[model samples]
Target: MADIQDFKSTPKYETFSYLPPMTPEKIRRQIAYLVSQGWNPGIEHVEPARASAYYWYMWKLPMFGEQSVDVIIAELEACHRAHPGNHVRLIGYDNYSQSQGTSFVVFRGK
Candidate 1:
């Protein structure tokens, strides 16, 4: 993964999503926390019809505030990259998503 600073500078988030068969409570909380901080989250389905690998998710940390955007993204980028296999999926931009300026780091796992 690239340096966290790179992530922070970027205007768009490297977002991702998943549709697996798992609750992933811990990740859900983390995601919610990030969203509260000012990041966009992707739409999720409860055990969709299509079969998939084990349920998992991961994503780049997006900037929440203008002043803290770089700082937040850098910090989260370091943490996320330090352990790629950890963080779950990050929400993508949608109707209820945040502003266009905000950026997010997104990923998923199985």
Candidate 2:
């Protein structure tokens, strides 16, 4: 028999999701935290039925340094509208290391 561990599966990335989904207010708070940490925020999404579903496409340019919280919220809304039946996520990039430092699935639309 093959090794059982080899048959097991794992997620491609570490992504956090809000159970019961997050309200707009909660999302704002989370974004606020990222901004306070001096991280850049960006959005990405993937179609549920697509092959290699784990792969995500960028929805907007990364916002770095201090930015208008409302703008982030607006972008989030636009992503939701554009991909009403897909999964959308938010990622925070640390400017210093130039890598993704935090991420979460902000929407799960079916």
Candidate 3:
């Protein structure tokens, strides 16, 4: 027999963003690519002092299916502007697996 606690686990996929914030144009291209792969985008943020915290709040709900890159860019920009002094991340969720497929830090500020 196995302990039931063994069944508890964190998300399997939690991709981090690239260092050195990407230009909006490049970010747009990446969003286009992810959308093509059937992934949806979402936003998350954490305090600079709590960078390693596990309680990142949802800045935006998951978006999927034919969503325009422009939409994602808008949300990204909004998140950046709102939390310029914190750490913001862009996450792509995989609907098929209902798990986070990838993520990246979009902004870093003190």
Candidate 4:
């Protein structure tokens, strides 16, 4: 199980497996995990594996201070590497302010 309590406890490389055919329970749990970062999902949609697109809407999770991007990249990369079968790909990024963290990440998963 992914320890949701470990968010602010000094993030480290971690493995996360979002269930195939993404279940409601799994999605809910993932939302909860992001909530630790002050993220709240407003919309979430999934398409078939053919298109390689996934979109999620989450409330702005403000990020203060520097090095936030590095931390997120490290974690996402680690999780992707750990689960080779899951075709994880970063699709887009949009952020207006460092203090106003992004709550959503558009990714492709197989």
Highest lDDT among the candidates is held by which one?
A: 2
**Tens digits of per-residue lDDT for model 4, 1-110:** 45344545532221332322344355444544554554322222233242234443222332222234445444445544554344432212223332323333223344
lDDT (Cα, 0-100) at 20 in candidate 2: 38
Best by TM-score: 2
**How well is each residue in 1-110 modelled by candidate 2, as lDDT tens digits?**
24222213423223343133467788899889988888899988887665144478889777656577888878877998998987778889998898878888777656
Q: Each model's TM-score, in the order given?
A: 0.26, 0.75, 0.73, 0.26
In model 1, where do residues sit more than 4 Å from their true spots? 1-66, 88-105
Candidate 4 structure lDDT? 0.36
Candidate numbers sorted by lDDT from highest down: 2, 3, 1, 4
Instruction: Indicate the TM-score of model 1.
Output: 0.26
Candidate 1, lDDT over the whole model: 0.37
How many residue-pair clashes does candidate 4 contain?
Answer: 1
| Candidate 4, superposed: residue stretches over 4 Å from native | 1-67, 87-107
Inter-residue clash pairs, candidate 4: 62-101
Estimate, for each residue in 35-109, the C-alpha lDDT of model 1 and write its tens digit. Answer: 565544432211221213444333343333323334433454455566555442334343344344222233332
